[model samples]
Target: MQPSRPLDVVYDPLYTTSTSHNKYEGHKRRVVPNKRPISIKNNSGLVSGPERHKYFCRPVLPHLQAETPEVLYASAHDAANIMSISEDLSASTRSIGMQTMYRDSHAQTDPFSPEYVLPEGAVAPEIESLTNLRYRKGLPVTQAEIRMIEHNRKKKALKKVLPPMSDEASLNLRKRMMEAQEIMDLKFRENEIDEAHARRIEALQESLAEREKQSQAINSERMRRLEKTLMLEKEDANRRNQHDRIKELRKLANKRQRIQTILNQGSKKRDLIEEYADYASPVYAPQMRNGNLVRKSPVPEVQFKDHQLMTLDSIRELEKNLPPQIRTSPKNQFLKRAPLMKKSRDQMTMETHLLNVESAINKQHVQGEEKLPSSPYKGQYRAILQRPSTPNYAPQIAEAGSEVNALRLLQRLIRGRAVQNMMYEGKDRRAELIAELRESEEARRFLSSSFQVPAEETEITKSAFSHVEGEVVSELLDVLQKELIRNKEIAKVYDFAQKAAEDRHQREIEEGARRQLEDLARDRHDQIYCFVTDIHRSTANDYIDSIFEDAVEDLTYRDSVVQSIIMTKVIDPILNILEEENSEDTIVKDLVSSFLFPWVQKHHTQDQALLEKRKYTSAIQALLAKVSQSMRI
Candidate 1:
């Protein structure tokens, strides 16, 4: 019979509050040293746990309270039991709601790390708590089984029995049979062999006669035999004769060259002596043709003239006499070759330039006395002499006797004068100004900035039209100019539209690239995670098989070798799935506590499918859904 649980270990409500209505605070003293910060000051704690208030300060958690009735203040054994039960509850709740595996997957690891291979039994490592494994290879062997094993192995190798005349023994028997048959043939006599040979000879003769008859029944012409040997003999004899003749000619030519070289050497020595001695020979004298003799000089000068030559005398003369401007070394090599551009092209040479300067100086002296009227310019007042000296009392200059008409006076005195002075004055008044300027040539050449062509003399110069040389070229050039102008106008109007479209397209491309990068990162993470997950799924069966047969095996809850196997195998996978794709926010902690925790409580603890591992997969899927909801991924 199985033993029952001890009464001492069995737990019940340690105490029920004597007065359930009111609460008490100060669950413990706050003078304990701890690694974490404490809320103690001046030997006084905040009255409760880390979080406390006057009205709310009490035992922080109901489980934290060790309150017991005096009657129930029993022995240390009961206290030990209480502590153990409390520890178990705390451990179960302490799981981060996750474990070490979940923390590792989310950590910032080294970038250069090679992919890690997961240990066996990462997923539902064991199916049922009581299950074990057995393998057929590990069965026991016995001493009497040895011969039987060999016999069976041989039988399996062949798969059947051998027939009589089939193996190597059969081959040997065939070889012997062949030898016996060959020996039996030797019983025939030599005379029989000779008779057979004679018969073969007769057959050969008959075949030969038939072949001869066949050869005779053909059309034929006599062919001459080529004597290759005689042709080779004749070629050798001709070659020998030619070689002898060539040798004789070579010897004669060598003797003639030696004799000529000796004679030429003697003549060359005599010629050298004559050339060096410079004797008065007839060859030195020039021959006259008819009565004419060679000219004494090669060239006759047209006239005696002085000219510069590149010589030491010319260089010395330049050094002593030339001005610095003309004798200077080369410089300004990069300067463009352009004609000198004077401001006034009329003074193209030095004489004209000097004339222009002299005249400008005279004009400046003449106009130097010009001055302003006053600092405060008066718009109305002016010298009476320059004011046209209007008639003082309607002088009879208009000849009042002629007509006293108002319209005629307006036309003559106002309109007529204004038209004559302002409209057509260029024809008369311009000529008068030019005559006056000519009289005062000094003023005409004035350097005053205010001097300008009179308005009366102002004429729009007409452009001279020289007919363009190439009509086709001119037309094409005009078309090109018009095309360029038209294109510029089009671009000015529509360029902004094209630029805006290009900018929009570029932004779209960048946004798409950003999304692609995000997708690639997500896929990379999935690939790494899938590597681990594949191992986990594969080890699921291996874990089941390892229970008894394997040296090391993942324990189920019933046969736990480490901390609860459910934490590593079942709970960890769910947590990993939740952690891998989640941002892990606390905003949705209520969802996990209210929805997921309750679901696991209702399903995992009650469903029979946990034995079949369906509960774990379902639980993980549900957890993943909650995680996704929290992350909003």
Candidate 2:
């Protein structure tokens, strides 16, 4: 049987067809439901609609019928009459509730109706199983019982592990354990040594194979080189044999040429002049191998002028007065002033020198300082460089755009022909502007045909009070149109000027550089000339002569002019050195002094300290220990 539902629904017997009023007694459906239509899902017969009641329980359950109706009626009647109290009420008030909600519910319902019966209390089951009953345990476990059990089982096991044996037995057991451990260690070490031996053998085999491979490669390379050498030797022998054969053929050709010449000559022998003429044929121009022109020396006497060919007396005097380096050193005599034509000189010396060494050194930072500043505004000048500069197209674009805009404005004014109308106001003026702009084919044809529009002239007398506004209007329009055309033409001219400036910028820069170079060269030439003149004048003066003889004795010369030239050339270098500015000289000199002084002083102090330590060395250790204390105090 299915489990009982929690909610029990009681059907009303009045809805069931009552047989009591008829001949039969039970209340049940009298009509049989039509054979149910088949369900497509389950293929089972179904009873649907109001006829489904015919399949409902028709059992004569008189037991439920007696109390079920009455209980249901009571519950529903109580629910109808009942009103819930609000949460605001006290619990005590609710517990001591008012009169029964169903006080008159029993009277409202048919208490004595034949179809209804009184409700009874729910019945209890008559039998129940007793095996699942729970009861208290017999006794509780104590600590003494737990201890007794552990002593019997756990204590015996622990005592067996940590045995209560004699010392000799324990020692015997340890000896056995040591023997087993030693045997195991020996086996493990043997395994490790075997592994190492196998690894070493494998490594040696690999190395041996690698060495064999290298040796084979070396042998192959040696054989290749030997074969290459043999090949080269064979090629060399072939070249030598070919050269010898060619040389012999050339000699035979010379013999044939001489015979031919003898036959051409009419039994005449050549003269000595003719024989030497071939040898004397003018050589190719005596010039630089690279085709540059060869320069000749300006000075007539080379060694004597340079002080290389000095007399014994001059040498002795020079040695006594001159510093070692200034007394014609080996470098001065062996200078490569003019090296062989085939070779470059160690030092290049021009025959006509424009810049002296002094000027060159002075112009290291600024080559043309006298003519040009170190830097200039680059935009104003043309750029002169090996590589081209990127162009700045912004100005070109702007100028072209402005010119186009001006031209467009001028064209619009000319084409629209609304000048007079625009000058005035009102709709009529605007209409006149439109009419003037509109071209008439008839007027164009008449003008092209050179025909005139015949009209009667109505002359009027001129008055002083006449309006002059219209008179100047045409003139003003003509002037305005001319000005617009002039502006566009001006813009075109300005654009041309800007382009010309950019295009010729490079040439202008080159010109400026050339001018600057010329100026510097002129200045240097004048400076050298003036310096030589001054030295010559000074040599003639008694005071200058006495001063040179006494203070500057090393540079004495036999020729006054040579001495003047040398002095001028030499003094300029000293002057350039004196003119130079060096802010770091003092700083670097002080730094060197600071470092040298401390280092030298430190060594001196160290030597002195050594002597002091020797003197104190023989003193007692106690005294030496107290020395630091004494110095500190």
Best by TM-score: 2
Worst 10 residues of 2 by lDDT: 124-133
- What are the per-residue Cα lDDT tens digits for candidate 1 across 506-548? 5665576567869999999999999999999889867877666
Task: Pull out the clashing pairs in model 2.
Answer: 382-505
Candidate lDDT values, in order: 0.53, 0.55
Give the TM-scores of the predictions, in the order they appear. 0.14, 0.15
Candidate 2 lDDT at 269 equals 38
